[model samples]
Target chain A: MLEAAGTPQEIEGRSLWRDARIRLFRNKAAVGSMIILGIITLMAIFAPMLSPFEYDQIDWGYIQEGPNWENGHIFGTDGNGRDLFIRILYGARVSLAVGLLATSVSLVIGVTYGAVAGYFGGKIDTIMMRFVDVLYSLPFMFFVIMLMVVFGRNIFLIFIALGAVEWLTMARIVRGQTLSIRRREFIEAAHATGVSNFKIIFRHVIPNVLGPVIVYMTLTIPQVILTESFLSFLGLGVQEPLTSWGVLISEGAKVIEASTWMLIYPATFLALTLFCFNFIGDGLRDALDPKDR
Target chain B: MNAIGKKKAVPILSVRDLKVHFTLSGTGLFGKERKLKAVDGINFDLFPGETLGIVGESGCGKSTLGRAILQLIPPTDGQVIWLGRDIVGAPHSAMQPLRRDLQIIFQDPLASLNPRMTIGEIIAEPLVTHKADLGKEEIKARVKRMMARVGLLPQMINRYPHEFSGGQCQRIGIARAMILEPKLIICDEPVSALDVSIQAQIVNLLQELQREFDLSLIFISHDLSIVRHICHRILVLYLGNVMELADRDSIYAAPKHPYTKALISAVPIPDPEIERNKERIVLTGDLPSPTNPPSGCVFRTRCPFAKDVCATDIPTVDTINDHHQVACHFHERM
Candidate 1:
């Protein structure tokens, strides 16, 4: 009876990560998304070594050729008859690069901006939040389009545009978290310790706010990736010779009747990429969440 | 104002007429700037190796005074003299070196320790910031030693704050404060968030640490019982004004101020016989707003002993004894 009583108590006292992993692993969609995302990351990382055909290599005679797995064109040919599989691999690299870089840039700027606003509070917070609101009200897509029009199509430009547009949400989330965190005794304790403002902000304030920032960052990546893809599809991102899932899908859509394989393969990859990101994000949302734990 | 030759003992920390006012902007149609006197001309002294308890209800500016003493919030008007140096108007750069000497242990143990930092990192933070010369091994050993001193197991040093209980977390906070070996520790309700049993343990721990280190402490709380237990002297505050300042036994045995009397009478004694025999003094109305405080004496609105003179002039602090002081017109007559 003693052993039986102790067993349930021990189970209840399990580690937070154990509980988080249980919930995350149980999410089939999230798990499936993880697998797909992992595979895409691996493909992107090892694209050069793995792909048989050169990404930039072209075949004029077989431009827009359909898939023939036996002939080694497993995902068919693109507009330049470049192996679609290789192109997709390279495109994965670009998408992941833009997504990660843009998210990071926004995270840095937004976290700093929001943390300051929330920690100081009062008029400073009001003024900073108003600025965020003003930015939020503006037509984000139109601004991105104008930037693209002015700067012309460049790979880095896409990252910049996405980062600039995506940071507002991150800033708002960080600010809200910081506002609540600043009220906590630890922050006040830090202040009372005579710790400098810089140290308090970086050491005490930033660490407490990281959980929410990380969760939001995970969610933000998919949005940024989607936006980059959309821009690329519109010919304002990842220009010629440098392909992306969006560029490939856009090319495939234009001549779907002649080469259905082009549309099918790129579209499938794009869908799978999105599905993976959303799934991993959901899994992370559950896993990292202190409340759920 | 005479020097009062007895005051030359040189208080470790002296605060004179400390005032912290926040300007509240008007919200609606007719906006007016209203100044909220959080800490209104409060004066007190903390001697070396003595625990000074500042007790008041929430929003009475006890916490604000603690912060103002540390210069965490720039006081609107006041002089916070620590070791003869006025820290109130000191530059941030000038105060950096002094920070290591003056540390604080906050009320909520869980909220006070950085949740993201491991126990070792949290304790070692001050050392790293102030004494950067210490090697990694020395820092680790020091943190481990401090943790052991605080009665926590060495292996638990890698764990985050959330993993520990409230009492244990408070111990971590104490460890963090004491690791610096600060001259003055401002404990802002350190044990108020713990269980009754835990409160005793923390209070005992603080007393032990105080005696062991010969440290001066500013113990701020609303619990009169706990304050009486740990403090050498107690300063009763009402609406950002000092109502009474006396030795622990004197204040508890014969509180001169009406506010102090009301506060002591309200603390429920655990023993049924003693509790039944004790006269309960309940003040009639709610505490007046500090934004628009009573004209002369802040406590006049709540005082049962209030008379015409109580409203016209703020009573000065009259010496009842060498160390005891009471700010009430009737204290002399009584």
Candidate 2:
């Protein structure tokens, strides 16, 4: 689209990555979602510092009370008399951190493993992919619980556990991408130029597969967040004082009739965050479309 | 044999009995593994500075032969002798140095270039791979020079392949191949993906560069018109086997093999009167599956003059003269 020969306006030619970046910024919904997501992430980070009361501290004076500006418990108190607003912020921290960190873990493990298998192909491909298929067949939650039990329930354990599961899909996605990409002319051209096999896999094969990898990454974040929430809902995730969106929502559910405001706030934040991520993912898919160019 | 005394220059590359067969094993149990002999027993000798055009229809293993020669697709059997050294099964590391001498220019100009890379990076990749000691500044300067030679503006070095026109993209592909100053370049239908108007320009550029580099070229294409213009000699392939090899003038003026005759007949003459008046040898029947090709001569099934001998015995390549060869059981009579 950036024809350099005749156009006077053209100074520097736009690389596909740069063009994609420009397109992403131009998409209003994606831009707005990024802004909103940034705000929520910031809010989650500063929740402890911003909130006047501790997340777990009970205000006996306003026990099970509705939101009131007088006490600064705007989102009101839970059945335990803890401040709802600060608890939601703390939950945001756990939820967002799980989404981002777990995806990063999967991205690292999945891309490298998948690129190696796909680029080498033949017997190596069969062996590696079958190994992935075996991992895929294992019961998802059982694997997570086993990891959690063995690792002593640390939050970092959750990151690895979710990542371990999500990476199977990631590996598959990247493998399928590179299977086609390896046969692409550019890759063959790379080989013809005598680029080492490892170099080709890491350089040519991996970067070309990034478009799909990134799209899957955005999808995986929300999926990980939801799974973490489900684990928390079952009371198996993030122990006592530490709270997540899932934990808050699950707690809010038990006291729904008595404290409706408690459920409303965290659920709104969780839904809004998921919505924003989906929009951003859609924007990315469109932006990175080679066909569109 | 009519003989004459002459000084013979040693061939730079000789491919003897080079075969590339792929066995496609079935997915399920008791699946039969079928042998697809893509380029079976191809033989040719390329002299320095000579352009050998390989012309064949689709699925004739023209591209396969080129790749097999380069060792990109390892040949299942036979010898690819490069300067008297057999390199058919050479290890990747051992072949790294050989790759510098045997570069390839691929069809589909845009696809051959890595889209993520800029024009500068794409052209510089071969230099970076082969010449590890060359400094980045020197590489960049060499790349800029090559771009100028290939007719691409050096200022557009940072632009991606998608940003360039098809013809321009092809120049970039050529620049990549020419950068290393390889002795031989196997151009696998390099201009097939370009515009008809642009094909001649690319072809002319290749010829100009060939003279500059003293390069032996294996120019493969389905287009005979373009091939005749640039190639010193032409080899016609039919179903993974050579049908004829002759000098450009002889092959065009007097084709001995039926398949070559048919192929040349299909080429439209530039003059309208000659084009309309010329006989077009339109052959019937689809190309037989390579898995189970017709026995003896592969072209016999559709050969207009096929005899019982053509079916029972394979026709070996026979020399008509020092520079011409043909494979037909009845060539002497025909």
Candidate 3:
């Protein structure tokens, strides 16, 4: 028999989450994106303190001005004479909030629904998954519009509307993952121990499925952000004085031929944020893959 | 305990005509419904402190039998009477307390321990669940004691299962199962996945633990030699049906069933001369598909002494002696 190694191997303690974090940091692109994302978040929180003018403050004399160093409007002014820089900064707060809040709502609902359906796995699974299938066939945008019309054009309601629609795919992903995880021997061992089904789903099943869920979350954030942009572009999201990146870009599009900086600034930030999210999502997928180890 | 005294003691567990048939998905919408009789109408009794070895080929339902007995998977039909209570149809709430008394060890040790949990947490789970009143200090003390008892170092408690070797992982699995001090533990090929040298170590650890706890074990394995080392009663299964069941001494000394004889002959003798001289009775074909087993007797198609009558009627188990039973039509002449 092999004796316990004389050296007692130095790797005596390490967790999957810890190791995954290490791997994630090692990817230069992921780290770079993380830094960019951090900077964007800070700028969004400190926008009011940092900007010289309020996002809605209009200087009628400086209307449609372009990149003037003298007046300190670095990126220039919009058609409404509002400082474009502050508008883009304020827009980020709404866009990021919508992305994060809606995605989180979807996360909780998806993981719970999927874990229950997958772990119990019988007539319950059949019924629950079929329900997801039915929802999948509905026109999601139309449903969101209906919700907006019924509930009024509140921004928080938009969070719920998008979250309620987006969770279908998350449920499908988590359910597929949970279906395989429920068959694993640890799950069987948990069942043998008489751990209540609810406890087992959360403790054993959900933790095992988190790798996929997390990777999918990064990807889903960008999708949620884009969906919010689409809603705002359609004039249904974040009304007038409260600006979003989508609202700025839509406002900029009208004067793209006359003045280019209006469309250029907000669109650049939106594209950069979306690109960073995709990079981080790709990095997480590779890092969490068991085959990589 | 004397053999006679042990026989007179009330059985700790009794399985009566347990059937676990799974319906297979049909190929086409109109394809006929098919049943795979994974564990077809099997019965056995387990006594306290005795290791009942269930030996069979792969796909012969040995694992299914173990799971069915523990009610991990609901059996299709029959009774799993534990201490006189029929648990076959027991509700999950009713089965919770019973699960504390009946535990299980699995085939793959690493796969059986959750990768996300520390070894300490994995072993303490049963205590936290069933012995909810146990204080943190008490739970830690018990977990540390169990880790040492299974030959794992107490200091290694915080590590995840992936950091351990296969043998050490199996030790963790053993520690987890034994922590609850269960009355019965169904070991489903616990050592089959380990190296030969490691297999002996695990088997010895299990035996030592069994003696200390007076554990009643349903030791399932396809390896006959390993089963011979730890099992008190030997049950030879073929295609989900019992071919022979007898005490180790009787079954090894004089196997009555033809299937039992063939299985015993396959065990390679240690001595060179005896190994060279012994005759081997290798079965001719692969195990018949459970979905379409041979008519009447499941094993008739593979039996060396098969006859027309063997194909027409299922053979009932015949009592050769008080301690031995053979399920074959012509066991007397065999």
Clashes of each: 2, 0, 0
> Predictions ranked by lDDT, top down?
3, 2, 1
Tens-digit per-residue lDDT, B1-334, candidate 3: 3433577788999999999999998889898889999998888888998899999899999999999998888999999999999999899889999998898999999999999999999999999999999999899889988987889887777899999999999999999999999999999999989999999999999889888998899999988898888988989898889889898888988999888888899998899999999988888888999999898778888889999989899999888887899999889888
TM-score of chain B of each: 0.96, 0.96, 0.98
> Model 3 chain B, poorest ten-residue lDDT window?
B1-10
List model 1 lDDT by residue over A89-185, tens digit each: 9988998898899999999999999999988898999999999999889897788878878987788888887888788888888898888888787
- What global local distance difference test value does model 3 have? 0.90
List ranges where model 3 is wrong by over 4 Å.
A1-12, A290-293, B1-5
Over A172-191, each residue of candidate 2 has an lDDT whose tens digit, in order, gives: 88988889989888888888
**Candidate 2 structure quality by residue, lDDT tens digits, B124-224:** 99999989899999999899889889887787888889899999999999999999999999999999988898998999899899889888899999999
Give the DockQ-based CAPRI class for model 2.
Answer: medium
What lDDT is obtained when candidate 2 is compared to the true structure? Answer: 0.89
- Per-residue lDDT over A136-238 for candidate 3, one digit per residue giving the tens place of the 0 to 100 score: 8899788888888898888998898889877888898889999998889998998999898878988899999999999999998989899899889999889
> Candidate 3: deviation at residue B106, Å?
0.5
